[model samples]
Target: ALVLEMKSLLGALGSSWALAFLCSTRWDWLRHSVLCTGRWHQVRRSVISFRRSWPGKIIMKGSSREWSGTMGQHNMLRFRAGQVDPMSRRLGNLLNMLMLGGQWDRRYYSCTVVVPENVMKDAQRVGRWVSRDDINTMGLLRHNWGESALADRYYPGLYKKLEEYHGVDFHESVMCWHIATDLILAKEEKEKEDFAADKRVQTVRALSNYMMFLLVNRPYMLPGLPQNWLYKQTCNNLDKICNDYDLVGSLGDSLWTVLKKLLGLHHHRVLESSGLEKKLADLIMKLPKEHASSFSETPRLLYARSVAVIILESGVVDKVRLLLDLWMDFLAYAANRCIRESHAQKLSTGGELVTIVWLILEHLRYLKEDPNQQHGHV
Candidate 1:
């Protein structure tokens, strides 16, 4: 039956004249398979001939089992497949479906070979597979489920699958926000009673897991995804979390710490080692007026101190001065917002101004070092 199917597929290829010519050049096996399968001796002889000739011819030009094996190896598919236990074939198939970017559709058939408990165990194994740098399976899940109807409809199921498998509840604020956003966008019910009950548990868990992962990894670049696209996704998640969760509470403190790490603003070591000074400057430049104005005076002063360091390192004092001039204009806008709202009392407006003066003093010291330095002669 398999041979007949192969022959039918090959026959369809004969309509293309070039394929016909190629097949004609390789017809010896076809002749043998048809002519010799009848008698016992002929069948043995044909089997030997078939093994030698069939695979080479059938694979077509410039392709080989070895080549496919190499591709599978590169994709981690071969390694994963080889690691599958004989008893866990169903779990393996589920994993393979996920690896291949298959979505969970109601119409898609799934055989119930194992109980939900075992299935959940298998799901945890799948989650572990995603932590490896080479596997990137979770990234695939996020790609498919982040903005899809499947994410909306099967979110609870998906989260349950993850939790049952991984034994972690992963209920971070950012994650909760992600679920909430998806639910809202999907026009899902937002019943307060349901929110406090088991109905919202899975969504909450999935978000929590995601947030925990991010907190530990502090990832600057997400593999198999563009940086800007990942940044946008993260920003949306962060915005939702902030809007829904209180920032002054314990949960808010945890979130603030994570955000500080994400923004590369936690420790001085991170600031220096992570190449984040300029990134922070860019972020500051891009912030909405309200957000930009929320920084306490000391933090703004520290930002100015960093700006001075950047200016000295840049070796373009004049250009740095011009950039600072423009930055002050932005600060003025933020200050105006604070003043109008009577929130200036809680922030340090004077410290920022003083920091600017200190920056000017440092620039003069840098300028006085050498006339030759200005012209890049040394």
Candidate 2:
């Protein structure tokens, strides 16, 4: 009995020490140390074993292999209740929230979130935050007119299309733009050339989908009033339209697939894209020739479709450039306007791209203000 008690005490102390080390800010050092010592293979096997066990299983609802590739890598991570003891599950949640470091979606790495080319030029010229006060939608619109120098110089006609959808509410603006972006992207499927290879087009698509993901799943993180009613009404109107065209079955299936993919229910297949865009394209082709009434529930849909038509009228080069610049602005504006507390809350359970963008901008601001400050201080 005494020997058993000693073993239990030693185990407890070992676990406590392990937890302390994991929670400390030495993860980078640890990763490097394991790599230098040639013991990463063993450590990786042990981590994967733990990941497959009950405690770690609670962190992922779907297949752990499909959700995130490695245990402590830079892949996106998620948390869910799994078939584990309640106490162990809670511990898993706590550990993930406190110490599990992961990056945002790999798709967003192409976005100029860390150092936007135009924003960088402006910052160097003015030595301050150019969009300091232009964080909200209206201010962003005003700034984009002439202040976004590169965009204006290249896509001078873009603002005319933008002005057509100007509004006071940020939620309404995001929905309108999102719908328009979807329509345009769906049409691009018919292009003969490999449009997907274009980085500008890729950026546009990524930011557009990312904004919708936030709108549907994390609306509170955005700078606007609750848009629950608007989102539901939009979905309902979309369902009605799909039903009218007898495409409801396909539409529902596509939307369900997309929702699951967005919520991290599973990982996307290697070479396939979501069916949502294709379904939306089919729906667009079935719209009535005449526009819907302003009071109709589907007014936003009609408006966005019309906007897509106007945008599509431009040359392919112009369309891609205009949209790429516009999305960069939208990303920056949203990141700037989001509340600090919202960012803090997301630090746990895998950080967000917007939060990272905001932090980068803050760091740039500090650098611009104090050029002599050491790099490591930030």
Candidate 3:
């Protein structure tokens, strides 16, 4: 194996050197002006020695034509510029990158698998059923019961609102849903149910925060032109609301303190979460009777608050079920619409949940469309 590897390495080096020599010979001015000098021959020998090394082998593995073409161009430029060492230096740097690029640790990312408290408490058969049937845990399927249920019985106006949010602008939709989800989660804290332990509730919260995080930090990963103005405007208005109501720690708190509260620090969660939601709820209540014109400037945020109120009117179980449906749909929607390059870029850093979801959806779609899949037994 080692002998074969060595033979291949020598073959590649010999080919590259031969290509380089041919190109150099064709360029008469480069040969006469640069190569004939005694010092130039020494430099050429040094470059060839460097090329014989393993890193050089990797560099030589690239397109010989491109490498030679680039080398000739750089040679002319360096000759004109009266800088001979920089071409070799630049080549060394390229070789270094090729050698070192794969050595760095890549952070791997994965979505958390949520097991509902009931699933944990129940028998394995029941757990298996939930795993197979639950959209929140599994993801949207071709014949999802939740999808059918929502299509059949959900409010037409709410469905229209969702369509509006999506069709008009995706970033706006994400912000709207994120705000509503946050408010709803805060509201649920007051209920008898243990929200922190509920799998669906946690899933809703995770995806909501994640979408917002992408909007703020990784806008390129999301679809559409990022609505920077909308995000900034909404944030400023929320700050004003917090300031007016003193919903943060105190009236005299520093900017950082207020920001910490806004971000929901572990210590400030109870205080800030409830206070902010109450203020937002009150603000939603105070909007003018004419809903269309009242909050025209910051409409999505207010509209989201209103949506949260409507969702809240349902029974706790129904409300949670409704929210779970909405968030899962949102997750799938974002995944489907996101560009391929964004997903590819995330691979070098850490992978994203949305990219994974996108892959799953694409695979499922392929399976659904396959001619052979229809006849397969379970």
Candidate 4:
């Protein structure tokens, strides 16, 4: 028994070092910024909207002039349960459907809370895929946008459960957009952290893990994706290639050229020299209609981010800070909860948390191996 305990403890520690060693490449790009855990330097502003002076961002010294904001602007990290709008309140009827309806989901599965349109819809629209915030209807105005691909992790059982009980389509693409938008915000955090400090590494790790989740466990995030797309493999390959080429920061188009050549995608294009844009979604996965189709509209990356802009635009320090705390909480949540076999069947085919992307591998390792507990495999 003592040997077992020691092995368990060592395994836990090993996972942490393994994750750090594995991501040492990405860590190099995390940019040096002071850790602002207990530091709260408040700068009061008369500006009401971010339309002029960017709401709350302060330019940090070093790390390429990156922008980071105050996280202590709120009195609470968890939101009031009744804070949602009427439409969002109605969505609370379905299991895992109504996000932020309870304490656990609000604190963890928070990206899907669907903060109402009345308060958050008109901030910005960067793409056609960027629609209103509606997780229930999936931010879809019409059903003909694209045929949905139900991923094994989120659909079938979820769909059947909803259908058998509530008689709703669950709006697969739109729901996926929630997860997609979820990622967009994470990516945005990553971009900002590139220049600022605070929790930069944590944000990057979360974004990396979340991207891996979308690519591996949830193909529904990429609707109409071909079965033979090989995007997941390509993404892993890019991670390796980026490491090999020392291509940190914004993976420039040159890496895409190498990636296209590596994947034989360069051979199929007969038309011309089209430059590929460096997008996180594109960098990590083979997005359908990547250049032309707005990533098949399954994600509409940063749609949720636009909603985030509204909160910032509201100029409520508490709202912005609340969101910041929630994101940090999510990072913690993924590290602790995402490694179970019930959540991911195989380390090879599962999310980065199961393999490489988890922020705190020791906690996840403990969760995965605790047989006395009921989760992981169930």
The TM-scores of all predictions, comma-separated, are: 0.19, 0.59, 0.50, 0.25
Indicate the TM-score of model 3.
Answer: 0.50
Can you give the lDDT of residue 245 in candidate 1? Answer: 35
Q: After superposing candidate 3 on the true structure, give the runs of residues whose Cα lies further than 4 Å from its correct spot.
A: 1-150, 153-158, 161-167, 193-196, 250-294, 314-317, 368-378
Which 10 consecutive positions of candidate 3 have the poorest summed lDDT?
69-78
> In candidate 2, what are the lDDT values of residues 1-378, reduced to their tens digit?
785565344333334344455446367777456455645455545544654574324442232222222111010001111112243334444655876311212211111122224433322232122433333433232353223623445656665665666445677777777677766766775663676666555446555655666665566677778676776576556645544555422212244643443344443222112454456455665566663552275466666777678777765455666665555556665666788898777654345666665675565444543443323134
**Candidate lDDT (C-alpha), each:** 0.28, 0.49, 0.48, 0.29
Model 4 lDDT tens row, 76-168:
011111222233223333433645333332322222111223111111111112122211232222322221211124223322322222212
lDDT of 3 by residue, 83-154 (tens): 113332243346457873111100001112232332222211121122223333335333322233245356
Please give the distance, in angstroms, between residue 87's alpha carbon in candidate 3 and its true position after superposition: 51
Task: Give the poorly placed runs of model 1, Cα more than 4 Å off.
Answer: 1-190, 199-204, 211-222, 226-378
Ranking by lDDT: 2, 3, 4, 1
* Cα lDDT tens digits for candidate 1, 1-378: 786676444434332343345446568776455434533344434433543474324333221211111000010111122222232334335756787312211011111111123222322222121122211332212221122211225233433322222211211222223222222212212223343333223322222222223322222111122233332343333333233332121111244643343343332211010112222223333445455434442232223333333433433323312222222222222222222122322222122221222233223323444544333221
Candidate 3 accuracy as lDDT? 0.48
**Which regions of candidate 2 fall more than 4 Å away from where they truly are?**
1-57, 60-151, 248-264, 269-276, 369-378
- Give the C-alpha lDDT of model 4: 0.29
Clashes in model 4: which pairs?
66-195, 138-174, 341-376
* Candidate 2, lDDT over the whole model: 0.49
Best by TM-score: 2
Candidate achieving the largest lDDT? 2
